[model samples]
Target: MFWTGPLVTALILQFISLGGGQNNDPDVLLESSFPPAEPSLMNLNAICLHGSGRARYPASFFPPSGYAYARRAGKAVNRLEAWFSQCCYEEGAKGHGQILCCAKQAWEAALSHFCTEEFSTMTMAHECCQQRGEDRWNCFAKQAPNPSYQSLPGYLAPEVPPDRIVFTWDPYTC
Candidate 1:
């Protein structure tokens, strides 16, 4: 078992200062993880597939409270990235609005999944989960480690499975 001692702390901190390492394959998971630093969500600069651009801190980046949360969070990121990749390659003709819509759906779905997991545990759901609509997004926006996803100097993303989410083009949904 990996201990969250100074060594691990220092390692994660190093990742923050000098960019994080790849998350490995989606099917294969790391042994253990520590939550992201409290103040800044810059712990890892998550790269979306197909050049869709960097995303806010993904659930896979910091994850929820425990190891059990890792698989779910990682899957959520995989789906998000997959949808982003589709948006990048397939939705180009549809305009950014459609791309953004896909993103929003994936994001909210991830959060809804997170809230479900939270309640599954002994702990109460995160405060932001209690809100809905723009309020939910606004609450999450405030908790971002940093406002923008800056490049991690020389970090690169690994190849993950192109998991897909069901998305239909409905302008009203956006």
Candidate 2:
């Protein structure tokens, strides 16, 4: 069920060692916000789940601001997977327009929250975090890895166990 605590915090720290996990609302749950979807159905290896999914980045961008941003950016894919189950498959919004819009929204919100957290600790936030609206999305879009969702050689997605890392989710400023 993925309780929201030790699982994520430990995953983040553990993933780095090996290696990691979010949310807000004391009584509300981000997990409950969307339907559950298996990671297999999610093309978890990809940075973006739509289009050619083509986007790459350079190093020094905070784990180069790409998939490895946080536990190979697992949470980003986690949210997208849930949205896909809820919006694309469950709701049957499979058209290009529907899926594209869903992916963009999912991508934006996931990255925005990532940036919000990233902004909190950095003396200078990542360049992508400095952007707002489409700019930020575009910047993140440019760094999408495995955009095609094709499996990376020798790379396997990790099994999500239990507990989730809790984030403050407080608004952060650069």
Candidate 3:
């Protein structure tokens, strides 16, 4: 009987710890304690740095939220940003329209590939967003499968001469 008492107490303690001890209600535990951070130009610039003669787009071109709704979303966004920074440098005023179009297409493609299928609903995204600080972003980042980037045909054709091709962007899709 004495041994049973200790075992039961230990089990109860374990359960309480797992449940966060202070609150057993899951809803309460997941509730957002603060409002979401507003997206800033500085934050966007930090992610998409301008250098190496690459064409630089304004912060408005990037997503407003820092938290990626899916695993692939994070990678795709990062890749798109990097591509713009590296490949679009020589483009000048006349190329701004093309650059904007490409950025929009890439953003749409990334969001469509992952966000549309699973994290489409605001409720699902909210679940991760409610998590505090970096935990929230980390939680969302893990929600989808990571996709590998592949160069599209004609863009980086091995048969084509090296001097002829100046730049390439990998194709990403669902």
Name the top TM-score candidate: 1
By lDDT: ranked, best first: 1, 2, 3
Residue-by-residue lDDT tens digits, candidate 1, 15-75: 5333322343322232222111111223222323323332222434442344445555555
* Reference-based lDDT, each prediction: 0.45, 0.39, 0.32
Note the residue pairs that clash in candidate 2: 3-163, 3-164, 4-164, 5-164, 11-20, 12-20, 14-19, 15-19, 16-19, 53-147
Candidate 1 ranges beyond 4 A from true positions: 1-66, 69-75, 91-93, 162-169
Error of 1 at 143 (Å): 1.1
Relative to the unseen true structure, what is the C-alpha lDDT of residue 71 in candidate 1, on a scale of 0 to 100? 54
What does the lDDT read for residue 108 in candidate 3?
A: 38
Q: Among these predicted structures, which one has the highest lDDT?
A: 1
Question: CA lDDT of 164 in candidate 1?
Answer: 44
Model 3 bad stretches (over 4 Å): 1-70, 86-94, 116-174
| TM-score for all models, in order of appearance | 0.53, 0.46, 0.28
